[model samples]
Target chain A: MSTTAIPTNTKWWNGGRSPFNASYGKVMMWYFLMSDAFTFGAFLISYATLRFSLNDWVDANHVFNAFPFFGHQDLPLAFVSLMTFILIFSSVTMVLAVHEGHKMNRKGVENYMILTILGGIAFLSCQAWEWTHLLTGEHFALTKSGAIEMLNTTVSHNPWGHRISGEVLTNALRHTSPDVLRSMILEHNHSATLASLKDLNANELISKIDLNEVYVGRSGPAAFGSYFFGITGFHGFHVFSGVVINIVMLAKTRLGHFEQRGHYEMIEKAGLYWHFVDLVWVFVFLCFYLI
Target chain B: MSDNVMTAAELHMPHDTSAGTGRIWKIFRLLSVITIIELALGFGLARHWYGEPELHHTAILFVKGTMCILSLAKAFYIVSVFMHLGDEIRNLMMTIVVPLCLFIWFITAFLWDGNSWKNLKNTNAGSKPDQTEQVVPAVIEKGAKE
Candidate 1:
């Protein structure tokens, strides 16, 4: 391979021809990511719309919490928290891989690439756990936008979730006070049951009740789950694609192409994609789980 | 093929090396700290426990948005230094950043339209009960049941 092509003589100077180089690959990836971000953004915005439109049904805390371990009480999203950390850690490793790629250290880049792939898998597993936990409980009963009208139907086709026990939700419901909840909804000195609570004022309804609403929709355990599962699931799909891309890059790393080129833009491009995944998770955590 | 002696300008060996652990590491560490703080904010906000200092919706939104802006910074850093995106011709940087910034604003606008004060107004409108235009039969059922 003669390193003889001068900058002026290269096909890039000709302007109209396709070089089929790494620049095109990276640009295409960026374009694809930008479009995908828009899609995710649309879903999230729609969620916020439906959530606010909801009269009585938005309960961020109770809906998204994890099944607590060992203490006989269910946890509050500890699993998702772990998922977030894992993703960020993976991003860190990805940056390191790019760094090593620059140094033409094929072995180091390959190792870190494998590590990033494993981290992505770990995050996906945690998400799988989170999804199953949400599907089984609470979403069967639909609530009106103003938090009134509990319709009778579970959201999922399966009655039982894969990870969480129905008993946990049953216990939560058992512990919840429909009486106090009712009182919270009723105006001062007014007695209104949850049954007769239709056409209740939506804003005043949530404003009056201090306690958290139970799981989100009759469609699912919480409304957050809809956003949670949808947004996180989509992002997870991106992570999966990234892993596949990395596997290809890893194969290239083994073949000594990266060393020959003496630049790790391919790996760096993958980092951009990976970082985007981590970035989206941050938003999901803040919007769906935190607030 | 014309046999020609190509100039050394042809030898484009990129100065790729272990330029990894310096400033970029520092920036990544900063990002990690921000993320940790974000987690703390999340946990703090999750509980509605009394005396825990409840934050307003605007406040929470600002804090959360800050995390996103930090990511934009990280993206710039990665592209500029790692991908050499910043070293491009002037039109190129504008081509990337300007539209991206516009998209951010666009995302923010739609989010607000669907979820912000406008949404608040919608909820208020939908939730307002028609006491003046009462559900008389429902009241009858209530009175009768009583």
Candidate 2:
């Protein structure tokens, strides 16, 4: 217990500083990001397995065809491309903020932080639009009987690019009242007649329907809806938290908090988190939208 | 305590007058150009503009491979430059990077396992008849009028 009691010649442990030469907080943040990366990686791998498991899956090009105000155009990958640019641009601004922190320029830090915050908000809004478009829009499936089924997706069911079984339709039909069935068909623009309804013979009635023509409510796999919502929703939550972290950092900067600490390493740490969020988006873009 | 107090200027960090501003702008331009190139390739070749039909499977795979590589490149730039990971001490770099490499390995292993599961489900002899066939009826068997 005495200082220098044993004079060891080994120059092993350094004192009073981190061996990594980085702040403890920054290194911890990296560790957290790495673990978070694994979570995302697992989700994506699950998506791939299930997607490849199916004989046919919804193509990214078809699934994400909608754009803001354009209303279901074939502008494949356009909106996501813009979102990618915006996120990357925000990463640039974050780096600038960190650089300004290094220079002790409060104004530069504030300005770049503001830009980064705006970019984060814009990205979030775009994602909101994307989610709303996906969940609320019309989806179609080609039934096993060669009849098109007009479908709406819930978290539990997605009909896009998957075939609905005749049994599923027949079973659903058995439970549905005739009035409800007729109204559902008319609502979704399926040209079913009361004569077909009165027949009570689904196979005979479905035979009268045209091939390649759409009908209403035949269940398809829930995998697509589950994965899409699960993965993107997770990423969306990360973006939301990143924005919140940035806003807090911005408030502290405005309150002269970092100046009181004699360095802006706090800002640098926040910048690290922001950059990590943007980095995750790049992968999400590739997995969900592009590839 | 007074001797322990190090001034910001003494840290020798970049100042307002340094060439760091130019470096930041250069990185911004590089990122933008790479993104634009990725977008163009994705739009033109993958989507098949100019009267071309959809790409062949191999061609589509090639495009996807290119996009993945480009995305990794973008991630590298953002992490190294924006996060300043490249400028950090080697131990610090490894502290972040080595674990991430394991993360990638985890994904690859799971993806390969998942693919095997898919292949197993698809080809195994004892499996139930392929659902693809039963999913949609080829022809509706009309019953006698009841």
Candidate 3:
């Protein structure tokens, strides 16, 4: 190939055109997402590593069984599936916003962006409820001294452990402190006054308590709660930031910034980020909630 | 100003808005279906409503594997269609994709090492004498005293 035979247009790296045939901003966005992927990948892989090394783990189904408005019903994986759909729907809206942006339809963009933002906020609210529930909702666990104690999941603690057999629970119940017994009885019978319940001896309280209502288990590995909070908290932070970005994008769109600039590429960039958040949730859902 | 300009290749790239929107919804439906299937499998296996009780362990592993594959499928659709990565130039796609292959090694190495560590801990360093119970030599003790 002589120099004269070479086509100038074919020299992609010759500096006047983009080798990727994409805007610099879009390329940078993709690179940022790629790096973000690695960050999440490392976190999730480390989670898997810890999980693989452990002899026992908290079953996700048991931990995530609660659903809003269902009280104490055992609806495993129900709430998270709803959250997943909310996120997926929001992703659809975001893509629609981008599509409308392509057509220069400001109204369509505004509507879809609003929907997308609402979806994000709704998902965040669900996460908040979930975190609060896990942190506050009490469960029975067998302590090291063979006493049954009421505890909730926190970053440092996990209450979803091996179920205490009926016999073990009966034995452990006798050894439990009066304070724990009162609380456990109160949990089962909300109508009873704390002072009255506290006045009752351990044996009397144990007699009043129904063994079937009591769900006692051994204390689970602490890492379960830590990983659960760490990874989900990180993902929630991403969703929060994505919402902030979308709000900024929405404001810019409303201000006609893109119109004046002659393109809606900024929205496209934001859409890429928003979609990436949804993409990460797919894996997060799989890793944390499903399996 | 140069950054805002579309290149020759980009100019030639198809912009089929109508078809594109249709495909987006199609992919959305596909994603939702896949998610639903994953959740069904997850819920069913978790509740012991599917598979034989004798194969419970294998059933869980199988379901987990299926969910992982389905999650990858969802990721692919999100990246390819929703993010418009499929429309990007081949070189661009390769740039984004090739580096992701590292995850295979990253996950395998970490998990393999983790499992090995578990084995090591469980087997007490593969048949070595219990370090805690090893007796200290009296000669060393005497030398330290001196």
Candidate 4:
């Protein structure tokens, strides 16, 4: 209890004490995060390895250019930057919650925990919209026969390929079938129904599509879609589980469970997991979206 | 012998309450600024504002390198401050930090092998064709039939 330093000669690690000078639960939580780090590290590294091996890959700018409600504005990285801010803000709220826990302020902890949960859900919602946009959105890709076809990005498919232009674009347009051309035109001129566009021949349909407006691309590296979905899906899964853990912790806090125990270490542990989720997103954002 | 049992006082040692909310908000601001800078660089690269024609590739690489370093800085703040790892004893911090060093070699070996594979494939094939060159056109041609 004295302010004076302990004797230098005293044995610091003579057993029967936490050599780390931390609680058992906290120590274990750190180790758990460490292992989880390795798991994510491996996934991201493999993704990089694949990326490096490929000569050409899908551009993040081309793929993630859509913004919700903005309607095909070509705002690259805009939505993802919003998602990153949501996660970061939620991380702030979480740290505030833990700070409140340190002060034994139950009301503060509850308020911040709710905010953090909302943040997590918002991030997940952004991710869902991104996946839906990628899967459902039609893109123009050059087929093997030099015809252009409309395609969506899938785990096995990557519609975002090298840009096709000039003579290649003209030739691909000529080879494209009437039906595919009709559908491709309908994508741009949505006022025309499939039935109305159905009557037009491939040549007329090609005329209907403004060559300047048509962004024709070929298939990119197949592994691009797989890694995008796989890594982000895995990260989204973690955020889902973290939100669940935070909810349980909130319920326990409201019920005065930690109050009874005289410590809110459970909240602290949950905060660790939440922060780890945010940490992983930083790398995920860097890998998938930025570099 | 007395240290064998963790005293109640030791288990729940008092924290410096006076450090206050100032530090938390400061860190929050720091993280936000870092992210904003990263986004700005990303936008610049995407818009082709940063790289000149001849030096474009290296310029883009420089921007990416800066972003990576910024991301690592953000990660450090989240771990150290938000998770309160900075306040923990050095021994505990070392336990967490030391194992992470393995990632350096892990990344290097994997990426080196991947690049080597690319070179091997290119050399064996006599010309390096994109992976999609072999499979996608054929698949699309078949799909067109359906």
For model 2, the superposed segments whose C-alpha errors exceed 4 Å read A1-13, A143-148, A162-221, B1-17, B44-46, B49-55, B126-146
Q: Candidate 1 chain A, which ten residues in sequence have the lowest lDDT sum?
A: A156-165
Lowest lDDT block of 10, candidate 4 chain A: A1-10
Give the per-residue lDDT of model 3 (tens digit) for A1-291. Answer: 011232445766666677876777788999999999999999999999987765556778889999989998899999999999999999999999988987788988999999999999999999999999999998888866778877899987788875666677789999998888887777778788887876678899999787887678777778888888999999999999999999999999999988777667888889999999999999999988888
TM-score of chain A of 4: 0.92
Runs with alpha carbons beyond 4 Å of true place in candidate 1: A1-22, A55-57, A67-77, A137-224, A260-263, B1-18, B48-90, B115-146
Question: Can you write out model 4's per-residue Cα lDDT over A1-291, one digit (the tens) per residue?
Answer: 112243556454777877776677778989999999999999999999987765556678778999989997889999999999999999999988887887888999999999999999999999999999999987889866577777788887788876677777889989988877776676678788887876677777888987776688887667888889999999999999999999999999999988877777788889999999999999999998888
By TM-score, how accurate is candidate 3? 0.87
List model 2 lDDT by residue over B37-109, tens digit each: 7777767654563123232555666767888888889888888877777776566688777767775667677
- Best prediction by TM-score: 4
Off by over 4 Å in 3: A1-11, A188-196, B1-14, B18-20, B49-55, B126-146
Chain B alone, TM-score of each model? 0.52, 0.68, 0.71, 0.75
Model 3 chain A weakest lDDT span, ten residues long: A1-10
Ranking according to TM-score, highest score first:
4, 3, 2, 1
Candidates 2 and 3: which is better by TM-score? 3
Q: Model 1: per-residue lDDT, tens digit, B62-119?
A: 6556656654665555556544455444444555567666666765676566555333
1 or 2, greater by DockQ: 2
lDDT of each residue in A7-125, candidate 1, tens digit only: 54455434443332235666576677677767776787777665543322333455555553533255565666778779877877887787777566789999999999999888888
Error at A254, model 4, angstroms: 0.7
